[model samples]
Target: MAVVPVRLLLLIVGVVAQYVGITPPNVHPPNEQLREQRGLERSLDLVLVTLRILLWSWAFIEGSILFALSGYCPPAFARPFLHLPTNLTSDPTELTPAFLTGIVLTLAGALLRVSCYRALGKHFTFQLSIRPTHALVTDGVYGIIRHPSYTGFMMHTVGYLFCVLDRQGPIVSVCTGLLDGSGTGHTTVTRVWACVWATGLYLIYALMFGRMNKEDEMLQKNIGEEWRAWVKRVPYRLLPGVY
Candidate 1:
């Protein structure tokens, strides 16, 4: 069997980290409740999930781009579209600093996020909705930061972007190709696709931060003194030292 290239391996790992979700799917908040109170959040999450899936799909295209650049070229049909500038100049098998950094971030984020999910147990949900008999968790990762999961997710997202949108990646290639001839293909298609990616990222950041505040307020309202005490003890929402 042919050994998979390090770049390919990193891409695969990043994709896995990107798609991993909370265990016991029932942990999701009640849609009716979320829609009733934080309708914007509920709507944003729908956009978030769709864009995320599209981002995941890009990994396959990135792999195809890499394979075309390597000695092992893809089939004749794909060769036309795989003409990314990096393909000719860069070695897909070589691991770049950006790629390595991205993989590390993705894995670290995934691990932290997963730990948070486990720590929260049945309390964790994709949306902000306090379940019946909901209790605040102040142990494990939650003790260090009130929103460690968000931090993990942000790290994972930024890292994955670094990895997949590097010079060798397809999106960058197209963006670069727009200015430089030897880059990727298409003009209108590339710009639109790039914009969609950008919008998705923006939504993720904006919505997550908003949701964090909403969560804090909700917790304070519901849990009262215990929530306030936990905040004082933790002192930070997402980061340990930084806000």
Candidate 2:
């Protein structure tokens, strides 16, 4: 029987521990008080809150399953540094300044996401179809970014890249890094796959935005010229000066 090296054994154990929620030293829960304070306290309000949580949970579970099945992990050295538990045995070179930057970006994105969730208040729902209670929230963070959720999402993606900057980032990262650096003839088929996934994400966002825009139009018709004036004031839709 072929024997697994101690280092590989340890790395596998660490990965398993992470998946089981063993509470890595670098992982910390977001502000609990702030999370609780933002939403409505009523029982009915739980519906929207539950839906929101479930949607994110689904995404995480799906991604994890897909990655595991594909047997792909990215190289952390070429990109970001991840502040993972020191107890985990792996490549020391994974820790770098770039990884730290990724961590900071990720945290900032998480905070923005939480802020957007708070801003949504009772209107937050998981279904692709807009709920009746949904309203065009143009105040708070929404005032600055038309789709604060998307901003939060972008930040979250950056954070994810940072967190996984080790041997577990993404399969595509590993494939590309190997091909680019080692001059190996290995082809990265996942590049196109990643692009497709990205396009899907963008399409989902676009659909959500379209729904919101339609809702906003209805709101404008109902509320009159007030919304139009606000739209004029907030010129940018997603990114500033771009689109």
Candidate 3:
């Protein structure tokens, strides 16, 4: 039977997970608390938010085009892009290690994020701000990692990258064009894109580190000993075994 490319399917699932985890009820900080954020913190928040929007928009558009091209008969609108690679469906039993890993991580991250939402309730916000009734949450996924949501976010980002990198699709094609203007599949372009993506991943980790520290400081000040004790009990921030 035919199916949408696994990577494309993964992309759709991941995006939906993000939307579900973040959209409803807003659950954001009040205007006063939001304004209290440090300049650098606010800048970082905006940058990350903007980056996600651009990246997800790009991924969805690219994935859609690739999906259309993957059909046994390419859509008339997609025919102009016929020069692109078109391996859409694959045997489930023969899935690549990277693809399987992406699927696992994406789902795991989504679940983790949802758990965090439940644990934090109204306290959760995309911004780093403490609400009037903000209380340090220690149960649920938080018991494992202080910043389970960040871990989830990292996992989702990395998983999506893995899914895209596992095969030649729009990312490869576009990066190739950007690298050498040939739009032809060039090995050098592939390697360059990998390096670029790795750099972006590092930036994400760095961003998370900053945000985590800021959050810890905010909570430590607001909640005092209780927050410190919870951190001591949990120990880890993003990863369980490592830091």
Candidate 4:
């Protein structure tokens, strides 16, 4: 199997898991309450959710097609979208060591993300809506990081990028190219387009951090000193040593 085909299969599974994991109708907040709390009607909420689902789902499907076409067909067709110099157009990419490792990371991330939700059980909602009856979750994965679930999401995004684009990771995301004798600059990401891809993916991790921060504030407000104590003990937000 080609990396792209494996990518296609994995993406299909991911999209399906995301769909099935969507908060059920029974878990949704009441229409009036939802409007009062979220400043959006139930219908509007549904629309927003539908749009999110469409965007995420379509992105993978579209990426798979583009990767496949680029790998197998004439370079000219996919050249405009591809980096100036790319291995995508060369010999078929099989299950290389890095690609296989990426597969493991992708699956691990998905599992970790899902496990967080399962641990939360009835307390978990797709949106930020919290029940008055809800309790602060600090056991299991939460014990590791304040937001291990988001960490898992980051893993999925990173793994996907690794599996398909095979761009440099976080370090490379911030790294810029230095011009070499070759027309192409010497850098982990050889093209501005590659940098854009890196930026977009990293932005999602930032978004997750923002969400986690807001969640911490909400938890602190609701749970008070106990929440403070948990925060002190856990310390880390996403990464253990970093932030």
Q: What is the C-alpha lDDT of each candidate?
A: 0.70, 0.45, 0.67, 0.57
Give the per-residue lDDT of model 3 (tens digit) for 1-243.
144465566667766765554343345567887626654555665665665685677567666655665564357866666564333232221345775676677778878888887887877777777678877788888888899988887787677666656544455555555455444545775576678778867776776688888888888888999998998899999889898
How good is model 4 by TM-score?
0.61
Q: Model 4, which residues run further than 4 Å from truth?
A: 1-28, 31-89, 167-193
Cand. 1 Cα-lDDT: 0.70
Residue 116's lDDT in candidate 2: 67
**Can you write out model 1's per-residue Cα lDDT over 1-243, one digit (the tens) per residue?**
133365676778778887773223345566665524454675765665675667667887777765655556657845775554443333444576877888888889989989987887777777667777688999998899999988988888778767755654444555555565554444544466557657877877887888888889888988999998998899998877988
lDDT for residue 216 in candidate 3, whole number 0-100 = 88
Of candidate 4, the 10-residue stretch with the lowest lDDT total is 169-178
lDDT of 2 by residue, 10-129 (tens): 333323322222112222233431122221222323533443453355335434423332324355431232322223222333333544554555556656666765776544433222
lDDT of 4 by residue, 1-243 (tens): 345556555555655544433334237554433313332322335643653565475555455444644457466656554443332322323444554566666677878778887888766654565676778888898887888877776676566555545433211221222223342332444465457657765555454555676688778887999999999989998888898
TM-score comparison, 1 vs 3, better candidate: 1
**What's the lDDT for residue 180 in model 4?**
34
* Winner by TM-score between candidate 4 and candidate 3: 3
Q: Candidate 3: which stretches are off by over 4 Å?
A: 1-7, 18-27, 72-75, 85-95, 173-186
Backbone clash total for model 3 is 0
